[model samples]
Target: MTALIEIHNLSFSYTGAAPHDVFSQVSFSVAPGGVFCLLGPNGTGKSTLLKCVSNVLQGWHGAIRLDGRDISRMKPADVAMGIGYVPQNQNSAFPFLVRDIVVMGRAPHLAVFASPSTRDREIARAAMETVGILSLADRPCTTLSGGEWQLALIARALSQEPQVMILDEPTSHLDLGNQVRILRVVKSLAGTGMGIIMATHVPDHAFIVATEVAIMNRGGLSRKGAPETVITESNMRDAYGIDVKVLHVAGGVERKACFPSL
Candidate 1:
C-alpha cells in the first residue's frame, strides 16, 4: 500500500538572531490505516515535525509527500483537504459555538466567502458525535473547559475528513476517562483506513493505539519500531530522563504498560 504521508531527510530551524535547529534528518512514513506515535519530552521538535508534515510550517529542508504528491508544491486548499491537524494549544478570538467551530473545518471545501451548507453542518455534527461531544455543540467554545476545548478541536479536525490526521499532544489536558476515550477513537479511526500521526507524552498510549512507535529526541529519532521493541526501560530513561518499569499485561492482551520506578 502507498504511504499516506512520507518525510525524507526532514529538518527545520527557526531563523532569527540565533538560529536553533529543532530536528534534523528525520524520516518516516505512515501507511494507510497506520497509527504512528511520536514519543518525546517537551521541545524535542515533535510538534514542529508534525507541523512540517501538515504544511503549516515552511522553510524546512526536506520533502513531505502526501499520497506521493509533494506538499510544498500543493495549494493550501489541497493540503488542507489532505491533512487534518489538531494542535496542542487551542484558542479562539471569537466566542463561536462548538458546532460552528467544527464547521469551520469545511472551509477548504467551500468557495470563497461561502457559508457552510446543510451538508457541511451534518458532517460537522457527525464528527462531534464521533468524539462524544455532540452534546456540547450548542455551547460556546469559550465557555468550555480545557479538555472540552481539546475535544472540540479534535472534532473540528475530524470534520475535515482528511486522508491523514496529525495530532500534537492530543491527550493533553484530558482527564483519564477522556484520555482513554480519545485513544480509543484514534485506534478506531486507523481501523477505518485513515493514517494517523500523533505526538504524545504518554508512552502507554503508544502501546494502546500505535501500530508503530518512535522515540524522538536530540534532533532525531533514537528508537522506532513496534511498541514492545521501542518503548523499553532504557529507551524511556534516555528520552525522558526517568527510570520506568515496562510491564506486560497480566492477561493475553499482548500489551505493555509503563510505570515510574520511584
Candidate 2:
C-alpha cells in the first residue's frame, strides 16, 4: 500500500533548549486504510507529534510529505483539503447547531466569502449519518453529552472529505462504552481508505484498531510495528514503566487485551 503521509528524521525543540528536545528523530509513515497509532505515557510528545503532522505547530526540522508533496510547501487551504484533525477536547463555547458546525468543514472547498452550498449541506448530512449522529443534527452543540459532542466533531471533520485524519486522545474523558464506540468508528473510517494517525494512552486501543503501532518515549519512538509486536509487555513496560500482561482473550473472534501486573 502506498503511504498517504511520510515522515522522516523529524525533530522538535523549544528555543533556548536545544539540548532538551521534546522529541527528536521521530519518524513514521501511514498508508491509506491503515491506522498508525502513537501510544505513550503523558508528556511523551504524543499530542505534540500530532500537532506537527497537522501543521498546527512550527520550528521543527524534518520532512513530512502528504501524497508525495512536502507539507511545508503545501498551502494551508491545500492541507485542509486532505487532512482533518480532532483534538482531545471539544469546545462548548458556542451554541451552534450540530449541522451548522458540521457544515463549517466545507470551508476548505469554498472560496473566500462563500457559504456552504447545497451540495456541501448534503455532504455534511452524510457525514453526520456516517458518525451515527444524524438524529442530533438539530441539537445545539453545547447541549450534547461528551460522546455525542465528540461524534459531532468527527462528523465535522468527515465533512471535509479528507484523505487522512489525525486524532489526539480522542477517547479521553469518555465512558468505556463511548470509547469503544469512538474506536469502532475510527476502525470503520480507515476501512474506507482514510489514513488514521492517532495518539493514545491506551495500549488496548491500539490492539483494538491499529494496523501498526509506535511506542513513544521521551523524545523518540522506542518501538514500532504490528500491534502484537510493538504493544508487547516489554515495550509497555519500557514506555509506561508498568509490568503488564498482554493476553489473548478467546472469543468468537480472538481479541487481545492488556492488564497491569500488580
Candidate 3:
C-alpha cells in the first residue's frame, strides 16, 4: 500500500532561558486505509506531533508529505481540506447549534460570503448520522454529554470530507460503552480507506483498534510496528516505565502490572 502521509526527520523544540526539545528525529508513515495509534505516558509529546501533522503548530524541522506533496509548503486551508482534527476536549464558549458547529467543517471549501449549499448540508447531515447524532442537530452543543459531544466533534471533522483524520485522546472522559462505540466507529472508518491516527494512553484501546502502533517516550518514537509486535511487555515498560504482565483475555489481550508481595 502507498503511504498516505509521511514524516521524515521531524523535530520540534521550545525556546526559553533553557531551551527544551519536545521531539527529535521522529519519522513514520501511514498507509492508506491504516489505523495507527501513538501510545505513551503523559507529557510524551504525542499531541504535539498530531498538531504538527494537522498544521496547527509550525516552525518544525523536517519534511511532512501528504499524498506525495510537501505539507509544509501547502496553505493551511489546503491542509485543513485534506486533514481533519479532533481535539482532546470540546469547549463551547457561546451557544451554537449542533448542526451549526458541524457545518463549520465546510469552511475550508466554502466561498467567501456564500451560504452552505444543499449539498453541503447533505454532507454534514450524513456525517451526523454516521455518529448517531442526527436527532440532536438543532440542539445546543453545550447541552451534550461528554461522549455525545465528542461524537459530534468527530462528525464535524467528517463533514470536512478529509481523507485523513487525527484524533487526540479521543476516548478520554467517556464511559466504557461509549469508548468502545467511538473506537468501533474509528476502526470502521479506517477500514473504509481513511487514514486514521489517534493518540491514546490506554493500551487496551490501542490493542483493539490500531493495526500499527508507535510508542513514544520523552518526545521520540521508540517503536513502530504491528500491534502485536510493539505492544510487548518490554516495550510497555520502556514507554510507560512500568512492569506489566500481558495476558490473553476472552475478547483481546490485557495488560496488568506485576507487583512483588511486600
- What are the per-model C-alpha RMSD values against the true structure? 1.8, 1.4, 2.8
lDDT of 3 by residue, 171-222 (tens): 9989999999899889888987999999987887887888799998876899
Q: For residues 192-247, write the lDDT of model 1, one tens digit per residue.
A: 89999999999999999998999889989889898899999999999988999999
- Model 3 scores a C-alpha lDDT of 0.86
Better candidate by TM-score, 2 or 3: 2
| Candidate 3 off by > 4 Å | 16-20, 251-262
Error of 3 at 17 (Å): 13
In terms of lDDT, model 1 sits at 0.89
- Candidate 2 lands at a TM-score of 0.96
Considering lDDT, where higher is better, how would the candidates rank from best to worst?
Answer: 2, 1, 3
Candidate 3's error at 29, in angstroms? 0.9
In model 3, how large is the Cα lDDT of residue 22?
Answer: 90
Per-candidate clashes, comma-separated: 0, 0, 0
Task: Evaluate all candidate structures by whole-model CA lDDT and list the values in order.
Answer: 0.89, 0.90, 0.86
